[model samples]
Target: MITVIGTGTGAPLPPDAEAALAGAGLVVGARRHLAAAALPDTAARIVLGPLAPALDAIERFLEKLEPEKPDERRPVVVLASGDPGFFGIVRALAERFGSDRLTVHPGVSSVATAFARLGLTWDDAVVVSAHGRDLRTAVNVCRAHPKVAVLTGPGSGPAELGAALRSSERVLVVASALGSGEEGSDEEGAEGEGAGGERVERVTPAEAAARDWGPAVSVVLCLDEARVLSPVRTVAGPPPGPAQWALAEGDFTHRDSMITKFEVRALALARLGPRLGEHVWDVGAGSGSVAVECARLGAAVTAVEKTLDGVERVRANAAAHGVDVSVVHGAAPTVLSDLPDPDAVFIGGGGRELPAIVTACARRARRSVVVAMAALDRVPAVRGALVAAGLDCDGVLLQSSRLAPLPGDVTRLAATNPVFLLWGVRPPARSEGVAQ
Candidate 1:
């Protein structure tokens, strides 16, 4: 059996952890952890780096005890930071050794401690791990939400986070080497400021990126002052979805029927499946009604507009709704290449290059793509582009009408133009459990 223990950010092993180490025949951890653990003289220690070797060593130790009596085998302890199960080595260990053969003891996560030091509750904050991953998603989350926590690591540390968030208004509260036991929060305002041991301080993204913050940072809290605490609620984490979507055309500024109807936008949103951490492009964003609605639904959206007035309209609509919709003032097909690949794409206004835009979006979309067309002539080519991109193609034609009051008390149906909504989803990869 394998025992994975979380050594809190501070040193000095707890009683239970000490007991495990005292009897451990083999130990696997980083040099810092190994040096602080003061393991038994007889125990075999492997300084962790390039995880495969350490896991292999543990496997060898476990194999040697295969024929020994269960009671005769000494304990094996693997030390980790915070919760090993949370984006740590425990996953690799469990995958190699099986969950049934492993036991885990968790410590306070660095994110939790950072929030605690601020005397704030985090039930409303979205926590994202940027460790060894792109900062774009995290940056977008910070831009849209009021409060967020980013788990920092070598490549995705404060400097990188700061540079990406330079345009955003979030004040970064960088928590460095938190809970190091070597320093106390009360000793100074910013614990790790210059002491180089442990500290916490608030700085603008521009300042953070402009200078070196050293390498001791454990986590960074990106916060917008206006959204610190939500109106009293029972639930947590981004509240819930808006009560309504696919808002009325009058609710947004548009270029005279140039915007998609509420009925079509509703179906398109459902097909696009926009949600947190996903990027959706609203090409030819006229007044950006569809882009605004998608942003309101919590997806990171980039509104691509060819006209300067249309770009301003999208920005105004986004500001009016209290959401972020990055307005790219350029036409599609060409502009699509430089932008980050999207999880979903909404082709709202593809002009003469409609087919090429659809092809480009379909090629890069990670999840699905939705295209709307008022003209029947473009449907065939759009469908062809989607199907040729190895996606599952499906479509629908929607026509709706509302009752209008006339001179009398009686009412008459006002029919709207019919729109064709075409969409496709990427086929599941063969490596996944889904049948190919």
Candidate 2:
């Protein structure tokens, strides 16, 4: 049987953890984790370095166990920081080896410690991990949401996040060495020993990093007031039906020839599925109609438009609707590189490089892609590119007409231009459990 244990960040093992470790024949964890736990001198230790190597060590340990020896009992123990199940190794192990084969023992998570220090509740706060190459999602969440708690690693630690956030007005709280009494002691005493031996109060980002944090865990909290600006418009309950989407094109102020038609825009919005704490790219955002609608739905939107007049029109529409949109003046593929990875992308122009832009967005988009085309020839090319990027592709040809009053005092259908609406939903990663 496999036992997964969480050595609380900065803290020693609780009594129960010590009991579990006494029975362990083989222990798997980082060298630091093994050292912190006072285990029997004879217990076999397997050091975990990087992620791949750590996983390899666990596999090798299991393989070498003598299952056939009737008199021998082999108990494997895995050590991780914070709660093993939360952004730790337990989920990976359970996904790989199955939950039935293991038992989990959790310790106090760093998130809890950070919140405890600030005397705040975190049920509403979005928690993100910046471990390894996963910092982009955390960065985008910080950009779009008012409150976020980031678990920082070595390279992408608080300094890196602070540099990214210097422009924005956010309250940053960096708490290090949670759960460790020694690290906390140094912080408490850093202000100088007092007559009554009073503990030091909370410190800022610079002060926290200047001290030596032994066996540390750091959490960065950013707070902004702009996130709650728009009170939820729909009634305080779940949406009624799958077809009930808010903010139709009639809701926005758009120039006669500039706006994407209602039906096509609806399909594009559906594909984008904009949400709070995610970013969306509206390339060739002609009238800023798509960008405004996305921002209204709580996404941080960046509208890319090339023409000087088009950019002005987009800005006017955005202000008329009372939504914040970052208007970028540039061409596609070239302009898209510097922007944050989008949760979804909508291409309303970029006729020739539509395929290339779609490909680039596909690599970055976490959910879906939607492209609008007036020409039939571009439809197949766009669909092929999405398919090539492993997205499930689908399209619809929309033909609509508005009511026109004729000279004979009768209403007639005034046919509008035909539009091709294509969408692609990126297949879920193996870790996400199911496709969206």
How do the residues 44-69 of candidate 1 rate in per-residue lDDT, one tens digit apiece?
99877677888889999988985658
Pairs with steric clashes in candidate 1: 191-199, 192-198, 192-199
In model 1, the runs with Cα more than 4 Å from the true position are 11-13, 65-72, 98-101, 132-136, 181-195, 201-215, 250-258, 306-309, 330-338, 350-364, 380-394, 404-411, 424-436
What lDDT score belongs to each candidate, Candidate 1 first? 0.81, 0.71
Cα lDDT over the full model 2: 0.71
Error in Å for residue 327 of model 2: 3.4
Rate residue 404 of model 1 by lDDT: 93
Number of the top candidate by TM-score?
1
Question: What C-alpha lDDT, on a 0 to 100 scale, does residue 49 get in candidate 1?
Answer: 67
